[model samples]
Target: MSHRALEVLIVTGPLGAGKTTAVNRLLKAEVAAGRRVAVLINEFGAVSVDGALVDAERPELAGVENLVNGCVCCSLRDDVVATLKAWCDQPEGQRPERVVLETTGLADPTDLVDLEQEPELAGRLRLAGLLTVVSCLGPVDHLRTRPLLRRQVALASLLHLSKGDVDPSAAVAWEGDLRSAFRHIPLVLTRNGVAPTDSPDPWRGDLRPVPEGWEATAGPSFAAARSFTTAWDHPVDPAALEALLLAPPAHGELLRAKGVCAFAGWAARNDGSDRWAFQLADGRLEISPLPLRADGSAPSCAAVVIGTELDAAHWKRALRALEVPPAGARRKVTVRP
Candidate 1:
């Protein structure tokens, strides 16, 4: 860290907590103010779907970039360091005033905040804040207060609750649980990533409540959760696929699921179509329409699944039950510690 001037807001949250949506909203505000802000989005899967999902009224965000195939907490740390270095090296007038780094759902914000301590960015990149999104529609298993989720919630300066409209009672329970677990962190209600109209200044402060005996250098708490990537040969049926996602595998607790699926002719649309980007976090399923990749070609991925104490046999059995399949073998994506 060298004489830092660029402020970075690390937006994070548990799986399906709506981290992407929040970042997009933040970006719109920053851009509206005519401030120079760059958004770096990270995804755990080899194939990235989130970059496109960040789209809003702008169709494509102006200063957004994707860091996929690795979570910044672990494998893609170098990519982050390099990108920031490049930005700082730019002409003073050309550098962005702020950077919004949206970590993968499985990421640990500490891993990123600690980067400010490194010599390279020690004084150059400042931690603006860490914002975490937690939604009411999450899976029953995530409600158990897993260490990974707790760690995410604990490190936030601001907490954004998504899907509160779906279940008011569940939202209250979630807010209560988080309030009981962490102090001083403010919770904001959000829908489709829009920040609450009443939210106070987001950059007010930062909080680090690392539990005793927890080493800052220690790897993220996802050790209990296993993640893998699986692909099929062709497109899938949306209705049938949602059915399987709602009923997860019998083997383990599904914490997150996402994929770029082909729905070439599943339905008719006067408007053109690409693939349907699907994500399951906590247990809520969100599906969106995705355009082609940068090369003008569709993405080459089917799906990615992650869960705690994964039972491979049972997981594969569930995949076999998909309404449309028999296209190819399933390959698991590994997250190196």
Candidate 2:
């Protein structure tokens, strides 16, 4: 009897760059083909909004794990290795055929490439390749300010140019810059948040060793990024919440914001569901209703924002204002000292 290395793929991108969307599309297709696939999402926040988003989209998936409150590239690196080892130890019949790891925007993908050689994971897990998702619609200035984005691009085996449908001309211009900057890396344009099927799948092939001198210079450490998280049991006013996400207290430096929260009496046109999901990236906002859980219960309600110089007190105060009051109760206002 021979052992088969667990196939693994790494997906990296900047905040609001559509990493979750790309991963969801891939997982959806893999499961539809009857392949046993799992996704591990690393979010730089206390609550795992990305993980909950995955659950909403692919309720049937059983291996969606989230590593939150830390970046696996640094703080939680050991935990990631342990998880892979545990997966490898599972019985053959219960093990997944493929695993996709989605890294946080603040994560340095370069640090994680060493996972393939970990003693415990050496033979059990195989590194496929790195896929970096770049949002064509986002402000290019982020590239200059966020060095992690450059490192992600430099380490990628495949560059996924997302949001092409939003602005074709912008997408073309972004592609030109990417081609000139990352000329050696292969790139693909994605429309409607879906990666192309005929293209070289980011996680399907043998690992391609990054050439010498491909590593980008180090920039600000992960410590430069700060995250704020809020959770409320009560449903909120959707309009007020949307406004808050669109314009953070410190709007200029706020990079990414996303979460699943309870919306008062909200339901999709096709389905009567109460839970809703919202995402704000690079000033673009998206809000949609989540599917009902299999058990017919509401999902967790929480939101998180990651950026530089975030005012935690202001965020807390603003979120508190959006909470919907109970039928006979008055809204409570807290004055922070």
Candidate 3:
């Protein structure tokens, strides 16, 4: 008899769509059920915020790795393959039952799925599912302006809506829009942390491998973009940060923006202190104080923007507009696979 390798689940989404939150939910549920798991976070920028969040939530994971400083599709393909192989080689008694990968927002699902077709990794790893989280508030507008978001929605096997509770009545129209985009997949509305299911057995066999030739049409290649990270020892003014993203330069081919930062003055209504989450998309921005941490410690900010052309001068000028003093001198940014 032959031994079977561990099953792997992939969680992906566009920037600011809440893929990390969904993975955390699934990890907690799996842990509670006595299943050991491992997580691999492929971040587009130099800093790893999503990876940090996962470690903070599940400190006991069998393995938690971060592939930062580049997009997974172009630069980290071999790294992902090598990592999965290492996990599979672990002793059977210590090997995890499942593996989860949280891809960068701008990443196309097909890029990661294509790994299975590779001769080296195909037999070692099994595709459990392709779970994608879509922010209900952003998808409708993003699809109109961003080609990446549209491709993300079109390739999902399990579609989850983050912040869906904001407007319950919009479910009907949302469902219709999803159906028009992805008629064959399952779209589940999730709120807080609960998924809407009539029965307890929510896991179904709906996820399948990406069809051939899915990547050629999924927007721009991950190889053509770059990710940069900047840390600030000083807290930023929430209002000022909001204004910068709202009026980012129209020059170049920039496509996506996302990150979290520390605010010194702004405070939540419930608890009066300084902590916030920032997200930008399609000329719109959202700024809200984060409640869990109040003291305004050393906050890090990272951004991943895709452009057809690369201009360091334009990026420098844009970063200057943010007004927060750079913690360390700016370093040369490059992509490594």
Candidate 4:
């Protein structure tokens, strides 16, 4: 039996390093160049937001799949393999030119490299390259304590230095540190998630081989972190939502938080728009209005907060406060947390 070959690229990095942003940029470039591409987004939280963001931003590109609630490098490895096999089984004309898998920030992508060597997928799937996005704004201490971060850098074919525009002075020092530590890997300084034209294209190269006897280093268990999602059916107040993300629960340090919220009277606008997206990563908060869904339906108002040792009760109560009717409102609305 024979199978059509599929190029696979893995995008990975630490939490808030902008892996999805890089993937989005690549997808736009590929689509503009008339190349058919597929994207597999693995998110740590149950309520996924990255997939929606990609869909809104890259509506022209099809084949976007979301794997949420688990890490693909471990518990969901089998599912990941199955998804790849299914893609390979597709008819030749319908197949994508390339497939990009954006792993959760906590994942160690070394395990997925073995997919090329899988008995069922040997000829069908090819491991093209691994691109790791590193945030220049992250504290230097993370290099010492976060073994997963080290593993991401050590196993990458290319390193993307993200968020350098946030702090140019600090980025200079960070780049110096990274060059001293991992000088072998090719590095690209990117701004606004845009990679240079000369950046290597994984699809154009020969497939890379899986490393033999690969082992992951010990790090804080991803299971030790917890996530809480609050979903509401009706529209929410925009200011209340922004305030919530601005000062997340004090009990735990927020690693990442993102949401697609349905709002009414958002930003004092009367344009009749209903949805907005907000993301909090590495202590920066970004909130922007979402493009209206093509289907003419509003997405549920929801937010997922991920962190270490969060106080669930307090967080839930804080979220419920968004339910109360502000002064001059006709009626109090019901909220679910």
Q: Local distance difference test, per candidate?
A: 0.71, 0.80, 0.65, 0.76
> Order of all candidates by TM-score, from best down to worst?
2, 4, 1, 3
Task: Please provide, for model 1 over 1-337, each residue's C-alpha lDDT reduced to its tens digit, 9 standing for 90 to 100.
Answer: 3334778888888777777777777887888888888888898765566776664234333356689777798888999988877776777667777888888887877677677776777778788788888887764345453656767777788888888888888888877776776657788777677766888656665656455654533333555557666665655667777887888566667778887777635663333455678888756687776765555565564677777777765554555445354457443433232
TM-score of 3: 0.77
Q: Tens digit of lDDT per residue, candidate 2, span 1-337?
A: 5458888889988888899988888888778988888889999999988887788775355477889999988889988998888888888777787888999988888788889889999877888888899999876665666677777887788999998888888888888888888798888998866766688877654445544664545554467878888777678888888787776465436778888877776644466567778899868879877867666766777778777777777887777778887788765445372
lDDT of 1: 0.71
In model 4, which range of ten residues has the least summed lDDT?
Answer: 202-211
Return the TM-score for candidate 1, rounded to 2 decimals. 0.82
Clashing pairs in 3: 75-337
- Candidate 2 at 126: error in angstroms? 0.5
Alpha-carbon runs more than 4 Å astray in model 2:
59-62, 205-221, 248-252, 265-272, 330-337
lDDT of 4 by residue, 1-337 (tens): 5555788889989888888788888898788988778998898877778887887784465477888888998778888888877778777767776899999887876677778888778888877888889998788778768877877787788888988888988778778877898887778889989878897764443324445554555554466667778775555666786787778567877788888876655452353456778888877878777765667555566778788878876676666566534566643344344
lDDT of 3 at 66: 93
Best by lDDT: 2
lDDT (Cα, tens digit) per residue for candidate 3, span 1-337: 3447667787877666677778888788777888878888998777776665565453457787899876677778789888888887788768777888888876777677666666766677777777877777654655556666666676666788767677565555666787786788777888854676562222343455566554454345565666544444445666766665566455655555556666645444555434455556434575544444324342354444444464645664455445444467453433232
Return the lDDT, model 1, position 129: 82
On lDDT, the stronger of 3 and 4 is 4
Can you list the residue pairs that collide in candidate 2?
none
What TM-score would every model get versus the actual structure?
A: 0.82, 0.90, 0.77, 0.88
